[model samples]
Target: MKLEALAVYEQPLKWFALGLGVCSTVCVVQGWQLAAMLFSLPFCLIWMYSGWLRTEPQLKYINMLFSVLYVYGIGRYFWLQA
Candidate 1:
């Protein structure tokens, strides 16, 4: 895709990620660990992709780490349930 197309999506994607982060926070506060991690994973992934697109190493790396952690948390949650 063109840079312009990516640019057009950037703001909306950021907003969506922010919304997911908020939902994750609310889930955490409500003691819904699995739901929180589910929300967090996508939030992190979105930020990671956004960071990669913007060439921001810090944002990318941090979000990548968070994404990995959230994935682990999600798997762990399921493993424990089983």
Candidate 2:
């Protein structure tokens, strides 16, 4: 795919990421750790990618950290389920 195509989708992806962040927040407020992590994993990933594309170190690293944490949380959730 061309970079132009990716550029076209950037705004939409950011909006979707925002929606995911809000959903994650709601899940947290509702005391749903698993669901929150599920939503947040994608949210963090999207923002991390966006940060990388935009050359924003702080945003990228912070989201990258959260992404790792969320992945670990999700993995642990399944690990314990097994």
Candidate 3:
């Protein structure tokens, strides 16, 4: 797909992006690099993309599981490194 063909934000996702962006920035600043990276990138991207694409509810549930895993990985990193 072309760069311009990407789905941009609607109301719900626009708000979600704003909140997640701020939280991710805080995590990055506090030395939670893994959390920040996961929250800022893959989690946010997956959430937004799936929402925008109107993916099936079951797939959205799977994405939610991935998000939970992302958070767990961040927690593990903090425990190991911090």
Candidate 4:
């Protein structure tokens, strides 16, 4: 798809991903099953890939920052178990 189209779709996907990440965090904090850990992957993918499609420089930078932070938090969640 075109970058513009991707950028358009990115908003809803980002929201969904954020929701999933929040759910994953809740599950993790509550001592839930490890299966919930997998949910963060999709969140990270959507956030990072969507950031790549952003055309506006300012928005792209913001996206990159948020995406990196989200991915890092998710990554640390897993690493903390090790």
Look at candidate 4 and tell me the lDDT of residue 33.
47
Q: Higher-TM-score candidate among 1 and 2? A: 2
**Top-down lDDT ranking:** 2, 1, 4, 3
Q: TM-score for each prediction? A: 0.88, 0.89, 0.43, 0.55
List the RMSD of every prediction in angstroms.
1.8, 1.6, 8.9, 4.9
Candidate 3 residue 44 C-alpha distance from true site, Å: 5.1
Better of 2 and 3 by lDDT: 2
lDDT of 4 at 54: 51
With a 3 Å backbone cut-off (N, CA, C), the pairs that clash in candidate 4 are none
By TM-score, the candidates rank as 2, 1, 4, 3
In candidate 3, stretches whose alpha carbon ends up further than 4 angstroms from where it belongs are: 1-9, 42-82
Can you write out model 1's per-residue Cα lDDT over 1-82, one digit (the tens) per residue? 7544677788888899899989989998999999999998988888887887789999999998988898888899889989
Q: Which candidate, 2 or 4, would have the higher TM-score against the true structure?
A: 2
- Candidate 4 runs further than 4 Å off: 2-4, 55-82
Off by over 4 Å in 2: 1-5
Clashing pairs in 3: none
Best by lDDT: 2
- Give the C-alpha miss distance for residue 19 in model 1, angstroms: 1.1
RMSD of 2: 1.6
In order, what lDDT does every prediction score? 0.88, 0.88, 0.67, 0.68
lDDT of 4 at 26: 89
Ten-residue stretch with the least lDDT total in model 1: 1-10
The stretch of ten residues in a row with the least summed lDDT in candidate 2 is 1-10
- The most accurate candidate by TM-score is 2
Residues 1-82, candidate 3, lDDT per residue (tens digit)? 8322555544466577778778888997898777676766565565646654675577567666767777777678778977
